[model samples]
Target: MNNFFPAVLRLIAKLVILAIAVIAVAVIVFWTPGKPADELAERWATPPSLFMDLHGMQVHIRDEGPRNDPEPVILLHGTSASLHTWEGWAEHLAQHRRVIRMDLPGFGLTGPHPREDYHITAYSEFVIALADSLQIDKFVLAGNSLGGRIAWTTAAVAPERVTRLILVDPSGGYPLPPKSMPLAFHVAQLPVLGQLMDYMLPRFMVRNSLENVYANPDLVTDELVDLYYDMARREGNRQALRQRFQQDDNGHEQAIIRSLEQPTLILWGAQDRLIPVANGYEYARDVRNSELVVFPDLGHIPQEEDPDQSLQPVLNFLGLAEQR
Candidate 1:
């Protein structure tokens, strides 16, 4: 019996050593340090990309199209996504209407908010402040995922600023958990794992998250992964991501959805597993003036997956379809 106890202790010690070795190897393999926004700007922030002082951060933004348009179209990308996500849509939309898209406080080159307040209310307020800074009286607000929630919230809080609403797989209408959350997002919500992520991030993690949101994993190219990976590595973004997940109330203020008076267009990926297409129906049912469109083959980020197909409805909604 004494020998048996000694053997067990020896085994336990060996296992502890093995665990430490494994962690050391992982740290060596995935030891990605945060990069200053200036370091990444040379490559990611080219022409048309400018940083403007707003809301206590140098906001990364792209403003395109005719300046005379009274009510421009403002596009907001989802969590973990930068303004690049809307590039395909922006390229085309800017041809006709003024399209403004930015890297929200927690993501992209904007880094983390000084106050570290990632509540949906803070995001909505930031949008309003951005509009005011641009001297825009009214705008057609369009957003996807978390950005969708912010868009609707902005409309609810500052109805006078939002002339129309376009929600693409927005994160609201019932607080139900995602069918399949991305590995990175899941990690960001965990205490230990999220803290570790602030220091070491693997390229594959970013790629896996992209593949999770994309219906066709093949569409997740190395270039796409590089962009997302680089953006995530922006100094303070990792910590901000963790804060965002913690602050997320999962659409607690969604009751205001029913009270939205602006014309609404709802878009969803029929194949979306993250938020599910059913939420699209919920938005349509609650918002009195809303239309829902679902794409059979796309996933959570239909706009990025298939911009051409996803943008047709938006064009029609904006009365620019005939022009195309």
Candidate 2:
């Protein structure tokens, strides 16, 4: 019996070593770096794409429509989403309003911020600087998820500059965890496991995240997943995301929301799984003069899921119905 136990132990050790070897080989075969901004710009960067030096970083922005529009509209996307997420909205709003969207630092072609600061304060400052550089004295600010949080904070900081505020499933107001989170976000928040993603990321992972955020999984296309996958590989982006998740402390959300006095429009997807639809009610309750519109069929990104339907309320709220 003792000899049999020794032999079994030896066999288990061999199996463990073999498994390790296989995993190492897989990692080596799939190892990859994020696509360069220049390379991604070739395919993703379309007409009207402009790059500007802001805070010593190259920012990718699209300034569309009539420049003379009284109050220009600035749109900000959610985490892991690029300025491209606003493409549908930009197409419609640009007719009568100058719509501007940019890839935030640590995302898309903009790459990562040198300072590695992804806090709300830093993001709000970035928005102000971008507006100042563009000489936009006053503008309408709208954002989704993280961008939404930044938008309200910006309005609180410079109330006079932001004529109107729009929040689309914006984060903050409530700290309750979602029913389920995107696997990629959960992995990125891990310690050692997150670092492995920097070396190798499968395209399927991107697809899964897109699927998770969209109300309809069919909306997740191969090309859309490619854009997300490639941009994630952008040098320094993965690390920047890790830092942002690790360092972000959303304790001051209540104070920020309570202090907001701007005319706010809160849009949310009733099917939103990331930041539950309940938070939408919380936002409307806190913001004194705010309107909340919930899309029964949409998920986290209603604007992208169904822009035509989602943007109608925004137009009405912004008093741009005449232009429509």
TM of each candidate vs. truth: 0.97, 0.94
| lDDT scores of the candidates, listed in order | 0.93, 0.90
Q: Candidate 1's residue-wise lDDT over 1-324, tens digit each?
A: 869999999999999999999988988889989999999999999989999999789999999999999999999999999999999999999999999999999999999999999999999999998999999999999999999999999999998889999999999668666789889999988888789899899898999999999999999999999999999999999999999988877646557998899999999999898998988888889999999999999999999999999999999999999888
Tens-place lDDT digits, model 2, residues 1-324: 869999999999999999899869868887877777888898878888989999989999999989898789999988988999998889988987899999998898998998999988899999999999999999999999999988998999999999999999998768778977888899899987798888888777889988998999998888888888888988888888898898787875787798888889999999899999999999899899999999999999888889988999999997787788
Model 2 weakest lDDT span, ten residues long: 247-256
The TM-score measured for candidate 2 stands at 0.94
True lDDT of residue 233, candidate 1: 96
Clashes of 1: 0
Predicted model with the maximum TM-score: 1
User: Lowest summed-lDDT stretch of 10 residues in model 1?
Assistant: 246-255
